[model samples]
Target: MSDPWLPSLITETPQAGFELAIKLSRMGVKMTQPSDEIRKKLRVIYEDDADSLIAASQVIAINYQTVAAANNCWR
Candidate 1:
């Protein structure tokens, strides 16, 4: 199979940048775990856990901050 292609993190707007941050967060989880079955099993537990969800949002926000800085806040 061909290698996966990762698009540039650079975005044209803050909204888009935030979306990219979310993608980055998800990709990190996938790469770290690399097991769909395990992730699915854990999803059921985290789906309803407020603290877990909040922690996830925090990670995404951090990623957004990094992306924004890299993009110079879209100038």
Candidate 2:
């Protein structure tokens, strides 16, 4: 965990920024869980759950907001 995946939040475009946000969200989950087997088991439970899906989307949206702000809204 010493290496850094987020050296900077800057992106060339909004699409890339959004992708980064998704990556950040995913990384957050991995950091929290840190177990591929358990994550897979949990994914089976949450995959078809609409509420869980929406919650995941919300986390991505929040991460996007942070990234967008860091990029100055790409303005």
Candidate 1 shows a clash count of 0
Candidate 1 structure quality by residue, lDDT tens digits, 1-75: 236755687898899999899999998898888899999999999999999999999999999999999998888
Model 2 stretches with alpha carbons more than 4 Å out? none
How many times do residue backbones clash in model 2? 0
lDDT of 2 at 24: 97
Q: For model 2, give the 10-residue run with minimal summed lDDT.
A: 1-10
lDDT of 1 at 34: 88
Over 4 Å off, model 1: 1-4
In order, candidate lDDTs are 0.91, 0.97
